[model samples]
Target: MTSGSDGRRPVLTGLGAVSCLGAGVGPYWNALLAGGAAPREVDLPHLNMRATRMYRVPGAAVPEHPRRHAGVPLGAVPRMAVAAALEALDDAGIAGPDRADVAVVMGSEMGNASVQEERRGAGGAGRPRWTPLAVAGAAVGTAIGSRRGNIGVGNACSAGGYALGIASDLIRSGEASVVLVGAADGVTRVGMGGFDRLGAADPQRCRPFARDRAGTMFGDGAAMVVLESTTHARRRGARAYAELAGVAWSCDARHPTAPDPDAAQLVRAMREALADAGLRPDQVGCVLPHATGTALNDAVESRALRQVFGPGTDRLPLFALKAMIGHTSAAAGIFACLTAALVVSRARIPANAPLEQDPDCAVWLPLEGPLRLERPAVLANTCAFGGNNSSFALTGPGGTT
Candidate 1:
């Protein structure tokens, strides 16, 4: 499986993420691998997301910040992105985002929650007229730029993961030498209500791979990584987090809200990724699943994993991040990928919270706790409501400082 990029592989140079676990990369990473729980509930402004406990980033985590482009107010999307991207930039040891070798791909499910609220209510005082500034700020791409390079990407819950795939493709296509890829989504009234209506919102909490797990809780978060051609990164003496090995995408071609449980196409997607990486199924160490806590989704994932990874699906350590971070929706895939890479880089897996192993889900889920490994390859999986299935095969770097 040769990389499409002039045969040059792309490597992960930096990573940053914001979650209910913590604010910046350090805090977020610390909390994620700690295996602890917080007294958290659905925390959103000007919204009623009750009967659910979620992972909310502290207000301090998203402190007031200036917009990337002056005039734009640094709102939730930007706040989340800046925290993650800045950390990545800092890690990459590059000041200023004006490098021609860089490219940006930012993904979001729901744009700015605050802005959407304003637009929906703009009806206030009179038939609300759309504000140009408001509309621009709400654009997902504008909220994320490298000052160096820019490309905005969005596709429902698979946004971030797909954006990462796009970034890898850009590099593989020889369009860019280095790329910054990220994903962000926040808890808002619209998002909460939508899921609540779908009967997928767990009012109490999020429990992934749990025997009694109900559903997912909406969460707000952003995750970013600096990816560069392996040659470029190695030449610069940068610390590599993991190899952005392979990525693949497919549509259920089945249904809008339901996954193709038979997994014919979904399994193909995983096989494609494995082929792209020139790796075999047995080489994979863990599985980073998009277990949304829905009965249908969880079961579909289980069936697919078994088909691809064999009965070992039960033995594979399935790191269920949503159990702790809730579902970041569009940012979910990328966030899970980042966490998986961190596991390889840090040599320690992040534990799932509120995870109760069910006879079904437990057989294939690493529900008990985190697992440690030195350098390992993992598959990060995500599925969108429209039968969109995406997967990224990643191998963690050798070491972490």
Candidate 2:
């Protein structure tokens, strides 16, 4: 990783999102401030399971953008991704000649499982179709007229954080002046069924850190951010939301479907990420935890926090986004990132509404209402199945530039 003295700092200029709360960043931020659960019963006939509730993006809320995959079979994941990418580009004011050198990076877990199921149900007879996993980057890049390059990340739930990290490296290395980073996942029969088989699906809404917490329920959504080198953004006079200070990745390799009980590797990831950003744990005013509402995940993450933040961990305001939007799977990390960026920029943490407190999960979570940030930096964490872990340090526009 390059140091801040290297003449480039990756900065976020634009954000886009499609989630259960609504489409666009404005609606998503508003819903977070409203502080209520938005999960509804899953109505897909093919996805019959014991856990029936999920947070889904309303059809009316999906943005209608010009399709780049016309006549090609596309899935909801890529569609949502393209919508988000377009919004990010527009928000960043990167258009016409400026987009020629931009890149697109996307991430997902089960790419287009729903589309695959649909094809299989149709007797598997069709023309050559583009898989959601294969065409996500291409579709978004083509839609935005970005011919520089396209990359896709499939690192489970941590894919979004990985995508952002890679995008920042590209900018820091002078490979691209602007990059669109994002992730998307659509709730599918195969995905829900797999979780049901594992008995990790929650029938009720996600309630992270709650004593009665069961497991995580899946949500369908996509989130994207426009990252550009500070020099490039300043040259264009673009407004910045936050600086993408640093990001680090790690894996525990403990279990195929469970996080390591010790959380040593997770702790290293967070500490290294803070070091990479040239910030201390005490400097991080807020944390966007990967609190999936599972009994083990919440407890393990709390332990990791205590290890990193020490005595200050008890008061380090943690925000649980999944409780409002449900777990967005691969897109969960970026959702947390976007929310944290907004929190730091706005200087206010959104309220967390866990049902009840769990004695084991003793992290500082503001359940009564929102809290003001005395510091400017925020840390976002993502821990995925198969032991993939990622951490990012972000600061407001006035942060480290």
**How big is the RMSD of model 2?**
2.2
**Number of the top-ranking candidate, with TM-score as the measure:** 2
Highest lDDT: give the candidate number: 2
- Candidate 1 achieves a global lDDT of 0.71
In candidate 2, residue 214 scores what lDDT? 86
| lDDT of candidate 2 over 1-401, digit per residue (tens) | 23464457888898989889887998888888888457887766655678888898898866554333645556777788888887888999988878878988888888756666776655648743544455667778787888887988998889988988899889988898899999999878788888888888888888899998888988998899999988889889999989888899999977998899899989999998899888888899999999998889999999999999999998899998899898999899889888887987888998897567899998888977678887888999998888999999998763552
lDDT of each: 0.71, 0.84
What are the per-residue Cα lDDT tens digits for candidate 1 across 1-401?
35554335788888887777776667767777676345375544455544545567777777465443444344576677767877787788755444444667878756655554655554554543333322212332343443455666668887777787888888877778788788887766777777777777777767766677666776777888888887777777888888878899988887878787687778888988888776688778778888888877887787788888887665677777787677888789878877877877776776566455666654455435567753377888888878888888887542111
* Model 1 CA RMSD to the hidden true structure, in angstroms: 3.4
